[model samples]
Target chain A: MKRLPVNRLSSRTSSAIIWIVLLTLPLWMRAVGSYTELGTQVVVLALAAMALNFLLGFTGTLSFGHAAYFGLGAYGAAMTIKYLVPSTPLAILVGMAAGTIAAMIIGALIVKLRGVYFAMVTIAFGQVFYFITFRWNTVTGGDDGLSGWHRIPLNLGFTTIDIEHDGKAFYYFVLLCFALSVGVMAFLLRSPFGRTLLAIRENERRARFLGIPIERHLWLSFVISCLFASVAGALYALLNNFTDPRALYWGQSGNFVIMAVLGGMRSFWGPLIGAAIFVVLQDYVSSHTENWMSFVGLFFVLVVLFFPRGVLGIIRRRTMR
Target chain B: MTQLILFNVFNGLIVGAFYALMALGLSLILNLSGVINFAHGGFLAIGGYLAYALIPFVGFWGALLIAPFLTAFLGLIVERLLIRRVYGRDPLYSLLLTFGLAYIFEDSTRFIWGAQSVPFQVPDWLMQPLSSDYFFLTGYRLFMVLLVGAAVAGLFLILTRSRLGIRIRAGTLDLETVSVLGVNVRILRTLNFGLGIYLAGLAGVLAAGMLGLSPTIGTSLIMPSFVAIIVGGLGSLPGTLLGGLLIGVASGITTVFAPSATEAIIYVMMGLVLLIRPRGLLGEEGRVQ
Candidate 1:
C-alpha cells in the first residue's frame, strides 16, 4: 500500500538510525549541555503526541482533550504506587486501565460530533477530570498538586535496577517503554484496521460507504489513542515522582496536538522530533525570560503560519525533490 | 430554603447570561466561518482590561459602552490581519492560530495589567439590594441582566432586520452562493467576526464586575461557553442561549446542594445531551455545516 511516502527500505534504515541515536542520547546529551531528564521527557511527550497522531493524523479526528486520559494515567500510577502497591509494572498497568476506561466512556458520548464541534466538546469534557483532581483535594492533592509520592526502584526476578537514583538507568527504562509503544503503533498503522482509519482520514464519505462502522471505529481509535496518551502520562508522573491536576489540564492537550503537528502529523516519528524541539525551546525560554509564554505563543503562530507542514514534512518534500 | 434557591438560581442566570453572550459570539463565527475562535476568551480578557483602563476616563457606564466597541475594533483588526490569512485552509490551522493568539493575549494581559486581580468599580447605588425579601437581587445584577437582554435582542434584530445580518445568515447557509450573488464575503466574515468579538468584549466588561477583574477571567469562563454552544445545538444561536442558561441554572442549583459538583453538573448535562440528542438540544439535523 502506498500510504506513507517513504518506502519500506528507507523506513527500516530510518528506524535503525533512530534506535541507535536514542540509545546513545543519554551519553551525548551532557556533551550538548542537556540532562538525561530532558531526553526522558522528550520520549514521554513524544509518545503522547504519537498517540494523539493515531487519531489526528491517521483517523482524521480532532480531540483537544486527550490530556484527560493522560492525567488519569498519571494519577492512576501515582495513586497506585502511593496508596496501593509500590510495583512499577502494576502501577503502569493500573494507569493504562484507568485511562482506557475514561476514554471509552468519553468516546461514546463524543463519537457523533465532527471537526470543530468535536474539538470543543473534547476540551470541555477534559476539564471534568481537571476539576476532579483539583477538588478531590484530600486524595488527589488539589491545585497544590499530588506530592509525597516517589517512583520506586524497579525489582526484576533476575536483578533489581535502582532507577530511583540513577537517571541514566531510568532513561533507558523509559526508552524501552517508548520502543514498545511505538513498535505497537507502527505495527498497527500497517494493519488493515489502521488502513481503514487512514481511509477515514482521506475521505470519510468513501470510508462510510465501504461498510465501515463510523462511530464504532472512531470510538475504538479514540480509546486506543487515550490508552497510549495515558501511558505517556504514567511515565510523566514517574518522571517527576509527582502528579498534579495540571497534567490533565486542557493546555496539556494543546501541547500534545502541537507536538504532533510540529513533528508532522502524517509522519509516524514526527511528534517525537516536535516534542524534542518544543521541550528544548521551552526549557531554554523559561530559564531566560519571564514572558516565555509570549515567546511560546509566538512559536505556535510562526509554526502555523510558516511551518504547518512540520520538520519531517519539509524533509520528506526535499528528499522527494 | 426557597429564598436561598432563588438566590442561586438568579446568580446562575446572571452567570449563564455571560456564558450565553460568549457562546453566541463563538457560535456566530463557527456557523459562518468554521473557525472555533479559541482566542475568543482572550478577546474577552482584553475587553475587561480595556474597560479597566478606560474606567478612569469613561466612567462605569461609558466604559461599558466603549470597551466592547474598542474590543470589536481590535477584533476587526485581528480578523483582517491574522485570522483572514488562515481562512481557506484546513480547520486545524485556524484552531491552532487562535490557540496561539489565546496564549499571546493572556500573557500580554498579565504583562500589562500585572497578574493580580484588580477590583472593578460599580456605581455605589447600583450595588444596593433592591428589596429586603430578595436582598440578593442587587440593582447592579438587575442592570446586568437587562443589559444582556438588550444585547441579545439587538443581536437578533441585526440578524433578522439589517442588511449585514441577513448577509451573515445567508453566508452561513451558503457562502458560495451568496458570494456568487455579489456579496463581499471577506467583508461579511470580518464584520461577523467583529460582531462576535463585540459580544465577547461586552461579556468581559460585565464579567469583570461580577467575577472580579483578573488575567485568569477569560480562561475560566471559556469552557462553559463551549459547553453552552454544544448543548444549545451547534448552529442555532437560540439553542446556545438556552444551553448556556440551562447549564448555568443547573450548575447554580448544584452549587446550592453539592457545591463541588457545580462545574461537573454542566458537563454531565452535555454528556446526557449528546447521548439523547446527538445533534444537541437544538442542533440541526446533520453534522456541523
Candidate 2:
C-alpha cells in the first residue's frame, strides 16, 4: 500500500485544537444563553450523522434507511421509560439493545444484496418498521407519537442528577457521549479491521479473493453503524422529550444521508460538518419560507451535481495540494 | 365469490398495467445505464401533474400526448447532464445522485402545486360503463387497458424491428464493443432514458385519473415499482410485465382481505421470492450482483 507522507504530530495537534474550539463554542453559547436549545439539537444531530459516516464514509456502503435503527433506539428509550423502568441509564441501555437487535436482524437479510439491492432492501425494512409503528397505535401512539413520557433522572450512587431540570447539564452529557463515540470510531478506523473494511469498499472482489469474508465484514459494519445511530437516537429522545414514528420515516433517513454526503463522506469529521450545515439550513430555511423542503431538495441536487465528493472531499483536495 | 374474484382480477390488471409501465422504464434504465433511477417516480409525478394541468385547456387526449413528450424531453436533459457523468463510477453515486434529484423534483412539485391533492376528472366520454351486466367495468379503465397493451406492443415492435432498437440492444449487450464498432453508445443511452421516462409519463396520466394526483403519490409508487423491476428481471420487458401483474394481483387480493397489511404484502412477497430464487422469477442468474 502506498502511504502519503503526512506529519502525525501536526495532524494530532490540529485535531486537538479543533476539538477544543468546538467544545468551547457550546459552553460559550450557554454562557451567553443565545440559541442554547438549538445548539444542543445540532450536537445531537451531529452525533447521528457521525454514526452514519462510519458505514457511508469508511465502509463505502450507502444505507438509505439508517433511521430504522435511529427510530428503534428512540422508541426503545421512550418505551422503557413509559413501561418498565424510568432510570435514564436503563432506558439508554434498552435503546442500545433494541437498536442492535433490529440492525442484526435486518442486516442479515439485507447485507446479502450488494449496492442498489442492499440499499433498496434496507429502505423496505425501514418502511416496514415505519408502518408497524404507525399501525400499532396501542404501543407507538401511531402518528401522534408518544407524548408526556417523563425523563428519567440520572442516578449515580454518589450523586443523583435531574437532566430535565437543567438543560446545560443534559447538553454536556450529550456532548460527552458524542466525544466518546467519535473517539472510539476514530480508534476503530485506525485499527486493522478498519483498514480491511476500506479494502473491501475499494474492491470487494479482490478482498473476497484475498480470503476476507466480505459478507460477514459488511454485516458487522452494518450492525456497528446501527448501534451508533441508535445511541444518537436515544440522546435525541432525551433532548426532545418525545418519540414518534417520524423518527423512522424515510425522509428522516434521507436527512442523515444528506448530512453525511454534504459534509464529506470520505472525511472523518465530514458528517459532523454535514449535520451542522443541514440543521442550520433547516432552521434558517423553514423560518423564511413555507416551501423549505423544495429548497432542501435543491441543495441536494446542487451537491450531487457539483460536489460529488462532499465538503470534506473539497477540504482534503485543498489540503493535499 | 367468483364475481368478486373476477372483479379483483380485472382491477388488478388495470393497476398492473400502470406498474408495468413504470417498472419497464426502471428496468430499461437499470440495464442500459446501470442506474436504478430513484427519480423515475419523480418523472411519473411530473406526468401526472402535467396531465392535470392540461385537463383544463386541452382535454385528456391532448394532455396525454403533450405531457409524456414533455417528460421525455426532461428525461433527455437529466441523462445528458447528470446521469451521463457517473456511468463508469460507483453505482452508489448514481443512486445517491438520483435520490437527490427525486427529492428536488418531489419538493419542487409540492412548491409549485400546493401540498393538497389536485383534482383530475376523467373526460365524460370515457366515464361510461363498458357493460351494463353484473360484470361491470368503466370505459376509462377499458381504455387504459387497451392503451397500455398498445403501448407495450409498440415498445416491443420498436425494440425488435427498428434501427434505433438494434443499436440500443447492441449497446446493452456490449457497450465497449458497440462503441468500438462506431455506434455512439451515449446517444443510445440518452434515448433509452427518454423512452423510459415517456412510459412513466404515460402511466402517470392514466394514474392521475384513476388515482388522484398528490405530490407524495410518486414516493409511494417508487417502492412498488422497484419491487416490480426486481421481481421481473432487471431489463427484461416480459419479466417486468409478469412481475407487475403478480404484484398488483397480490396487493389487490390482500387489500380485499386485510387492508392494513396491504403495504407489507408486497415486501413479504419480495422476501419470499428472494429466499426461494434470489435472481427473481425471470431474472437472469448472476446478473443481479
Candidate 3:
C-alpha cells in the first residue's frame, strides 16, 4: 500500500523519459551510429506491436495473423497513391479503412473461437491475403512487390511540410502519427471497454456470467486492434515507398507477436521497446550476415526461455520486489 | 474437359494426402500438449533433407526407412530440451518457441543445402507413367499414395491397438486424469511430439520427391495443413485427414476454372466451414476451447 504512490510516480517519470528520448531521437541518432530512417522504422513497428498487444495482452486473445491487416493497409496506401489518388492523407485513410473493413469481416467469422483454435484460423486466413498479393501479378506486381509510388508531402493549406525530400521531417511526421495513435489507445484502455476487456482476459467465464457480450467485445477488440495495425502499416509503406506480399505473410505476424512478447505484453509501452530492439537487431544482424535468420531464431529461443516476461516485465518485477 | 477436371481432382487428392499427413502430426501434438508446432514444417524439411543426404549411402529404399526415425529422434530431443519447459504455460510461449525453431530450421537447411532447389531423385522405374491416358499417374505418384495410405493405416492401428497410442488419445482428452492414473505424462508428451514429427518427416520425404526440394518446401505446405485441420475439425484426427483431402480436391477443381485462385481456394473452404460449422467437419463439441 505504501509503495503505490512511488510506483505511480516512477511510471510517470519513465513515460516522460521515453517521450524525451523519442523527441530527441533524430538529433542523437547519427551520434549513436544509427540513421533517422531506422528510428522511423522502430516507431512504425512499435505501433504494430502495441496494436497487437491491445488484443493479446489486454483482451487475452492471441491473434497470430495481424500481418494480414498490416499488409492490407500497406497495399491500400500504395495503390491509393500509385493508382487512385496521389494524396498522402487520403492514402492513409484508405489504407486504414481497408484493413479495418477486412478485420470486421474476418473478426465476425472467427469471433466464436477461443485460444489455440482462434490463432490457427487467424493464421490460415492471413495466408489468403498473402496468396492474393502474390498471385495477383497484374495489379499487385506479384513477387516483385508494388513499387513506383512514394509518399507525397503534406499540405496544411498555409504551409507545406516536405516529408518526401526531408528524412528528419518524415521521422517527426511518423512520430506525430504515433503519438496520436498511442494517445487514443491509452485513452481507450482507460475507458470502461478496456476494463471489461481486462475482465475477460482475467476470467472469461466470470465476465460472461456477469452479462458481458463476449463475442461482440472480442470482435470489437479485434477490429480496433487491426485499425491501429493498419495505421502502422500505412506509415510503413510511406517509409519504404514500396509494399510487398511479404508484409501480409504469417511470418510477419510472428514478428509482430515476438515484438509484443519481447517488450512485455502486459504493459502499455512494452511493445514499443520490443519493436525498437527487434527492428534494430534485425537491421544490424541482417547487414552483418546471411545467416541472420539463425541469430534471430536464437534470440527468440533465448527470450522465451529466459526473458518471457520481457524487459518492462523484468523492471516491474524488480520494482515490485 | 472431364479429363482435365479428373486430372486436377486426382492431383488434388495427392496434395491433400500430403496435407492430411502433415496436419495429423500437427493435430496430435496440438491436442495432447496444447503446443502448435510451428516447426512441424521444419521437421518435414529435415526429414526430406536427411533422406536426400542418406540416399547416396543407403539408397532410396534405405533412406525412406531410416529418415523418418531420425527426424522423430530429433523431435524427441527437441521436446526434451526446449518444448518440455513450456508445457503448462501460456500457449503463446510454446508457439513463439516453435516459430523461432522454424526460422532456425529454414536457415539451417538453407545454410547446409544452399538456397537453390536441389534435385530429389526417384527410381527411373517409378518415374515412368503408369498409363498413357493419365500421364500424371506415374509409378512414383501411385507409390507415394500407397505409402501414405499405409502410413495412415498404420497410425490408426497404433492409436487403436497399441498401449502408447491409447495413452496418447487419452492424454489428449484429459491429461490430468491420465497423469493421475500413473501414466508418465512427460514421456507421453515427448513420444507424442515424436510421433507428430514422424508424420511431418514422412510427408516431407514424399513431398520432396513430388515438388522441387527447396528450403521452403515445408513452409509452403504448412498453411494448407492448418486449413485441413480447421476444415476437418480441431480435435479429430480423422477429420483433419478428411479436411486435408477435401481442400486438396477443392483447389485442384478450382485450378481448372481459376488458376490464379488455386492457393486461395482452401482458405475459402475454411471460411465456409467456419460459417457453416465452426467446430469443423469432425471437431468435437467441447474441444474447441
Candidate 4:
C-alpha cells in the first residue's frame, strides 16, 4: 500500500467500482429514471460485446458473423423450452452447445483466411443461418419470429428463484451469468494461452516463425468467443422470451463489433461501459424518434472519426501522459 | 417444362448480369483501395431513387443516363470527405465507417422516399412482349441485357486499353510502386471508387424496372453480389462475372424444381465453392490467402 504501482492500483479500484455499481444497479436504476430490464439488457449486451472483444481485441482477428452463433443460441434455448424441455438450465446448456458446435465447424472452414477476406467470409456464412431461420416459417416462424415461449423459473434444489416474473430477479440471474463469463474470460486472459493470443495479435508473422500454430489458436479463440456470445444470446432469449432472424443478421454482428470498438478494444472492461452507453442511448433515441437509425449511424461515424481509440482508450492515454 | 426451364435460365442470366455489374464495381474499389465498401448497396438505392425522381423531369432515357452520373458524383464526394480519411488506417476502421454510411444511406433514403415501394416507370413499348412464343422476353428485358453487355464490354476496354485502366490495374497490384512511378494514387483511388459507384447506379436504374423500387432493393441484391465475388474469386473481375452468372443460372434452374430454395441455393453454392476451392473458381492463389 505504501508504494503500489499507479496503473495496477487504479485498475483494481476501477474494477471494484464497476462490480459495486453493477451489483447495486437495480437499487439505483429507478432513481436515475432507468429500470431493471434496461440494466439487464446492458449486462447481456455487455457480455456479448466483451465476448466479441475477446476475438477482435485480444486475438486481433475480425469476425463479422458472430450474430449467427448468438441467434443459434437464442433459437436453441427458445426451441428447447418450447419443444424439448421446459428446464431453464437445460435450455441454456442446449443453446450454448448449439452455438459452440456451429462455431467449431465454421471456424475450421474460415480460420485460414486473414484480414478482410476473413471478415467477408464470416459475414457470408452468417447469412446462411439467417436465411434458414427466415425461410423455415413452420419451425422458426420465419419473418414473424419465434414466439409463445417464456423463460422458465430456475428450480434450484435448495430454493427456487422466480426469475420468470420478477424483473429484478432476472437481472440478478443475468448478472450472475455475466460475472461468471467475465471471470472466466479474465482468468483466461491472464494465462499463458491468452499471452500467446496477444503475441499473435501483435505480430502474427513473428509468432508463426516462433512455431506458434496460428490457425489452431485462432480457431480455438473464435470458438470460445462465440461460445460466450451464445451464452449471452441464450440469456437474451430468456430476457425477451422471444428470438428472431434479426438476431443473426450481419447488421447485429456489426453492432457487436461497434460496441467493442466504442468501449476500447484494448481494454477488458471497455465493452461493458460501451454497451451501457449504447443500450441507454438506443432506448432513449428510439423512444424519441423513428429516425433512430440515422442517429445511430451518425454516432458510428463520429466515433470512427473522432474517438477511434474509444472512451477508455482516451482516458488511459491521458492518464499515461 | 422445357419452356419453363428456358424462361428461368434466361431470367437467371439477367439477374446474374445485375450481380456481375454490382460485383465488378465492388471489386474495382476493393482491388484498388482495399475497402469492402459495405455502403455499395446504399449507393445502388440512391441510384434507383435518383432515377425514379428524374423520370418525370427527364424522360426515362434521360433519367437512365443522368441518374448514374449523379450517383457517381455522390460517391466521389463521399470518397473525398469520409472514405479518404480512413484510407491509411486499419481496415477495421474503414469497414466500420462504411457500415455506418450504409445505415445512414438506408435511413436517409427511407426518410426521403417515405419507406413505401415507389412505382418506377418504363416506356410502354419496352414493356411489351417481343413474341408470343417467348412471352417472357419483354423488350425492356432484352434492352437491359444489351445495355449491361455494352457496359461490361466498355469497362473491359477501358481496363485493358486506356492509360487510366492500366494505372488502375498497376495500382491494384501495388499502390506503393504505382505511387512511386509518378501516378497520383489518391486520384486513382477516387476515380476507381467513382467508376465502381457508376456501375452500381446503372444496376439500380435497371433493377427498379424489373423489381420493386424501395430502399431495401439495395439490401436484398447486395448479398448476391458478395456471393458472386466469392464464387468468381477474389481480385479477379472476369471471375466475378462468371461467378455471378453461374449462381444466377444455378438458382434459376433450382426455381423450376424447388421454388422455395431460390434464395437459399445461392448460399449453398457459395458454401460449396468455399469447400471445394477456398481460393474461388478463378481467384489467384496468392491473392486472398
lDDT tens digits, residue span A15-34, model 1: 78888999999999999998
Across A141-234, the per-residue lDDT of candidate 3 in tens digits comes to: 9999999999999999999999998999999999999999999989888999999999999999999999999999999999999999999999
Binned by DockQ into CAPRI classes (incorrect, acceptable, medium, high), candidate 1 is medium
After superposition, candidate 1 runs with Cα above 4 Å error: A1-6
- CAPRI tier for the interface of model 3: high
Model 4: CAPRI class: medium
Candidate 2, residues A1-321: lDDT per residue as tens digits? Answer: 123335365467657876886677667875754566677788888888888889988888888888989998899989899888778878888998999998997787766677776676677678777887887889889999988787776788899777877887777778888888888888988898898899988988999999889889998989989998998898888888898999998788888988888888887777888888888789889999987767787787677678778887897788767
Given the true complex, what DockQ would model 2 score? Answer: 0.50
Each predicted model: what fraction of the native A–B Cα contacts (within 8 Å) does it retain?
0.72, 0.39, 0.84, 0.59
DockQ (Cα-based) for each candidate: 0.75, 0.50, 0.89, 0.74
Better of 1 and 2 by TM-score: 1
B285 Cα displacement, candidate 1 (Å) = 0.2
Model 4 ranges with Cα > 4 A deviation = A1-5
Q: How far is each candidate from the true structure, as Cα RMSD in Å?
A: 1.4, 2.5, 0.8, 1.6
The local lDDT score (0 to 100) that residue B204 gets in candidate 1 is: 99
- Per-residue lDDT over B1-289 for candidate 3, one digit per residue giving the tens place of the 0 to 100 score: 9889989998999999999999999999999999999999999999999999999999898999999999999999999999999999999999899999999999999999999999998889999998898888899989999999999999999999999999999998899999999999999999999999999999988999999699999899999999999999998999999999999999999999999999999999999999999999988998776
lDDT (Cα, tens digit) per residue for candidate 4, span A171-266: 999999999999999999999999999999999999999989999999999999999999999999999999999999888998898899998999
lDDT (10s digit) by residue, model 1, range B1-289: 9999999999999999999999999999989999999999999999999999999997999999999999999999989988998888888889889988999999999999999999899999999999999999999999999999999999999999999999999998899999999999999999999999999999999999989998879989999999999999989999999999998889989999998888888999989998899888988897552
The number of residue pairs in model 2 that clash at the backbone is 0
Ranking by DockQ: 3, 1, 4, 2
If the candidates were sorted by their TM-score against the true structure, best first, what order would they fall in? 3, 1, 4, 2
Decoy 4 TM-score against native:
0.98
Clashing pairs in 2: none
